[model samples]
Target: MSLPRARFDQFRLAMMLLTRLPVGRISGAVPAMDKARWAFPLVGLVIGGIGWGVFAAAVTFGLSSVIAAILALLATALATGGMHFDGLADFADGWGGGSDRARTLEIMRDSRIGSYGVLALILFSALLAAGISEVASATAFLLAGVGSRLAMLLALVFMPPARADGLGRMAAGKGEASLIAGTLVCAVLVILAGTTGAFALIGAGLAMIVIGHSATRRIGGQTGDVLGAIQLASETAIWIFLATSAH
Candidate 1:
């Protein structure tokens, strides 16, 4: 296949996996996850762009900032079908309740939410909504989305998979190329957001790295749940940073 056509197929696979958007239909076999690894950040931008529209429209319609923030969160969630949120919850529960790798992996794979999962979701979500409450522009809101997903992609590249077979392994090959591609996308976002955007991106990226390291130490490597948790933390960090930088 031509390079552009191959790239288009990769992006379509990304959208099909990470979002609820309709990307029509593709011919032939589905692309592998690794080919689209670098495109995760781009998918986030698309999701965030829709979310920014929701937030901007809410504000324009005379809604309060808090309500607008809630709308924005809802829009993002709807777009992605809350898959990341599920991962975040599973990571929390598995780590909080398990003492070892086998137990933790088992816990994470269960389709039930435990006490730790519930608390983690509540706290992270509250912070995410609060951060959204302070989003002052479409740029900041969109940047947060790109930054968070970039964080997830970076984790996939920099960290090892906790298990032998999983999304983390299939979605990335631990190459710097994917990292560079994702970072370039994030850099564009930061440039568009100004100095504050740069600041927020730095803060968010640090938080994601920290999460990646912690997951490595705890679970021996990264898992899909860990990626989800990283995304949540990174996005929240950016929002908080944006709120602080706005001051």
Candidate 2:
């Protein structure tokens, strides 16, 4: 295939995998899922954009700050079909309740939401809402949104998988170039917003790495749940950084 066509296909697959965006049909064999992983940030940008737009619209309509913030959060969740949130819930249940790696994986696979999952979702959502309410700016929303996905991409690229086979493996093992490409894209997006965005992205990256290492030690490697958990943590880090620094 021609290079541009290949990249386009990757982007299509990335959109399909990462968001509920109408990417239409994915045609042909997938170009390495790892290569498409670079476009994860683009999916994030769309999700963030939805949040910013909704918040801006809510504020324009004279909604309270808290209400506007919740709306923004809802927009992203709706856009992505709440899949990441689901992953977070599962990871929480598995990690918190399991005594061993095998048990953890088994718990994560169950469809039921346990008490741990419920608490995890609530705590994470509260942090996210607080950040959005405090930052209260579309730029902050966009940066946090994009930065978190970039965090996920970096985690996928650098972290090893706990299991011998799964979605994580297909997207792992050759994510270096993808990470660089993703970082460049993230840099452009963040810098275009402002220098503070650069700092925010760096903060998000650091949080993701820390979480990545923690997940590795706890579970032996990265999994889809780990990636989702990293995204949640990274996004929370971005909002926290912006909230403290937004002045």
- Candidate closest to the true structure, highest TM-score: 1
Instruction: Estimate, for each residue in 161-226, the C-alpha lDDT of model 2 and write its tens digit.
Output: 777776678888754777666677677767676766777777787878887887787788888888
Model 1: per-residue Cα lDDT over 106-217, one tens digit each: 9999989999999988998888888888765777777888889888988888788888877876885667787666688778878888898998988888988887887888
Q: What shift in Å separates residue 124 of candidate 2 from its native position after superposition? A: 1.2
Worst 10 residues of 1 by lDDT: 172-181
- List candidate 1 stretches off by more than 4 Å: none
Best by lDDT: 1
Give candidate 1's error at residue 51 in angstroms.
1.0
